[model samples]
Target: MTFDLIIALATACVAFVLSKRSVAHFPLWRAVVTPLASIIGSGFLLLGPILNIGYGGYAPLIMIALCFVAFLFGGVIRFNMAAGEQAIQNGDYGALAIRIETLSSWALAFAYIISVSYYLNLLGAFALSLTPFNSDLDAKLLTTGVFFIIVFVGWSRGFKSLEKMEYVSVSLKLAIIAGLLIGLMAHFGHRALDDALIFNPPKLDGWSALTLAFGLLITVQGFETSRYLGSEYDAQTRIKSMRLAQWLSTAIYLVYILLISYVFRPDQMSSSETGIINMMQIVAPILPFLLVAAALASQFSAAVADTSGSGGLFAQLSRNRITERQAYLLLAVIGVALTWSANIYAIVNYASRGFAIYYGLQAALGAVIAARQNTGWQRVGFYGLLATLGAVIALFGQPVE
Candidate 1:
């Protein structure tokens, strides 16, 4: 594990340097890689168990279909970004876009706070679970304290330093997850073959699958972050990046689901908040500790990234009504409060709804863009109805676990 950590850090450092250089020199790299990195994280732990337990052997199929749905949503966001950029270019910064932006920013902030809170709870739980502190309250308190400290550091120093840490955290996270998949392949190769042939599992109702997907919506939401990068990149680049991000993330997630589904018994997996740890423990005792470390790194990186995003959006939407630092701190405080009020699963549900609402706004923006570009009336109606349906699902969908 120690050697693996060193290797992951070294790889991340190199990758970070290359990525920064690419951002400076190559627009394509800037477009492809930046969005790609931002789109994946520890949210998979929550997503995977829920998906597998709900859909059994059919989780991969559901995930594939969901990924395509996410891709369509990504297109909506991309079109919206293009429209916004065009609006700025035409010197028409329209009222509708501004209203949507303001509302989306608030929703995005709410979602990020909830996400941070849930991750803090997860990290605290993983840490304590390794020891004797068995109370959920104790974990929440410890997580709150840790979260506050992270917020203070981020607010004081800003994301410049945090961005540097992201390379390491992201690399460690991907490497650990990949390692787990590889480890599973090695340990259960013959068993996996037999399991594939058997493929016996409980029936998965369509409504249950849809509800589970809605509940886990936040896991696939990182592609939308590219919409916020409009100020940094041109609309074309941002749109392309969003498209690339959705593709890359879809492939990665599909591979992970395939490996884990074949490797682990569906009945053995449960809807535990520490589902990753539970999955890893069944494979090897040491695997949980490594996954815990990876989870901590991923969650910290995610919190810092979202903090920076929410702060920037708040500042932009407010037209400098509040300073970025103040916005960040306020978000952190909200996160801390939320951590005390809900456990990880409840937070997941909140974050799913939060992001779902934000996506609906983006879809509305897509409709506006379609009208402006004089695109087909079909696209206009498609995005319009998608926005309505997304909002409805988010508002009323039941969570199975």
Candidate 2:
């Protein structure tokens, strides 16, 4: 009860602070991904699975690479905000978000399609974890439900519904995660740190390390969420939130990876979609129950939030004429279709490939624009190119078995 109270109060405080510093949709001190379930759903949960299978035990190396991914993400966010402002000043914000309208039209297609895939991943994982019914059946129902909800909410209430849901879900997720951390530390004691150090990775040299790290960069691409925050924040407020969110996300990533890597045996970690829950079980027998119950809320909130968000983005592409109801229907229809794949890893790998391609193009496009408009744009383009190359490696370099 005491711990729960502390968690609640702390989350409330963070939300309050974020709300105060917010402009447009950007909140001070809050990670933008927090608003949508995808941050943890896509990036955090997949970390263990991707590392265990793809990179083996060299996740720390990937995480180090992710730091740069984080920075590039920051720059992307800044660019969008700056671009939007520039457009607005020029009285051209009607298509400001579509700054490169034709190019962005394609970009939006790629992003929203990838987002649909991501939405299914979240919903599928949830069904795999909870309920006694068949995941296929459950997934279809959930997907359909999500689509209707998004359309209903989006048209009726607008993007604000997403921010509002984020306010609730993010607060809950942080509380639950903090509790998990405290539980792990309390039970394992400081000796767990020893586990992190025991796994010494083989040296691949600096250049090779960078190359391999670049391949893994796609895994950490979730932090630039602020870019979608146009009309939600002023430049000053957005920049502050952008930097803080990335650093905070990094900190969370480090603590979580260290926790899992140190506390559980390497072999015990399964590629089960709910692998995090499995890891918690090793920490304490009762943990799975606690975690499952907690994760239940986290998952549902996350699923609904993500489903709604993807719908919203698509609606934007349709020039709001597609209507929120239509977007929700679209999301549901897609999720039902994706639920056909029973294999989680295959779905995830494909989704990663898709997202990498999407971000790759966005960075490339952003870079081209920057080059013509700003000499510094070349660096952004190049960085994205390297990251895209790395993503290609993740797909092509390894057998992906």
Candidate 3:
């Protein structure tokens, strides 16, 4: 009960602090919030258990590796933001850079399609987790309903009204995540003092483990959202905010994975979609409630963001041949199909592959720009390697079993 009270108090304090005008109104913070929110979305709810169950005590290490890979990808995007944009504006790279950029945008639009399904499906699962209607079919039906709502709202009213929910949702989700970390920390300390911490062996090894990590790329996929905030921020601001968002999210993820890895036995981790909620039931009674709240806010907001993004990208890339309304309808149809055809884990894999293809194209574009600009063989080689890696991940990444 003491721990529960502490967790509740911590959450309230963080929420209150985040709601203050100084923090809420800061320009850099506001810019940071978008990508940060997206980056930490449904992944926070799912990755802990997946990593803990799959990698055991080495989960934190795996988390670090995931973040590092994401940071490298982020570096590619950042370069494109700084240099590629200028080159395109000046017509310095001929049509090759322009072509790759177009292909990447199209890839991103498709990736967003998969990712919206990923977010809303998790939202449905978490929404029904504590209720009596807690089955796969129930979750799928709920997800389908939400898809329709998004489509209706988007087509009828536009997402401007719903997009405002992002700020509040980001604050609430971050505050709840703070509380979860505090609870996990206290639990971890207690276990350490009692010598009850467990360091289980990895359940996976070698090539299988490598491919699984590839599939999980979407867990760290949202940093690219920062690259698209051009209308709201300058190139420099976007680059700085993106770097900050990735760093902060990486820190949060590493701590969460580290704390959870040692505190729970392999058997104690739930294998279901809402497994984290059940696992948190042991950490503190308040934790499950807080987690569910965070899950709902983060997932819904992320879905809306991606849906809006997909619509805009499709409309732009198609030269308005596909209106944003038609794109929303297309997304709704595909999202529903995904919800019915695949489980959340499989959707996660598909989303990861989709994003990987987008990142690869971005990397390929970066390499072309670098080569044309005489940016040195080493930099060009790095980008080429990243492009190959992204392609490999897209081709070989497998779903979690």
Q: Model 1, range 96-163, lDDT digits (tens) per residue?
A: 76677667768886777777676677777766766678578888878888777776777778756666
What C-alpha lDDT do the candidate models reach, one value each? 0.70, 0.53, 0.89
After superposing candidate 2, which stretches have Cα over 4 Å from the reference? 1-37, 53-56, 85-101, 116-124, 127-152, 187-219, 297-309, 373-400
Q: Would you list the clashing residue pairs of candidate 2?
A: 23-232, 23-233, 24-232, 24-233, 25-232, 147-328, 151-324, 151-325, 215-390
TM-score of each: 0.87, 0.74, 0.97
TM-score of candidate 1 relative to the true fold: 0.87
Evaluate residue 203 in candidate 3 and report its C-alpha lDDT on the 0 to 100 scale. 88
Write the number of the candidate with greater lDDT, choosing between 1 and 3: 3
RMSD to the true structure for each prediction, in A, is 3.6, 5.4, 1.4
What is candidate 3's lDDT per residue for 43-162, written digit by digit as tens?
788999989888988999999999998999999999989884756746787788888898899999999999999999999999988999999899999999999988998998875755
**Candidate 2 structure quality by residue, lDDT tens digits, 41-117:** 44565565445444445665566567666566456546655655456335453443245444443444444444545
Q: Model 1, which residues run further than 4 Å from truth? A: 1-38, 86-94, 193-200, 203-206
State candidate 3's TM-score: 0.97
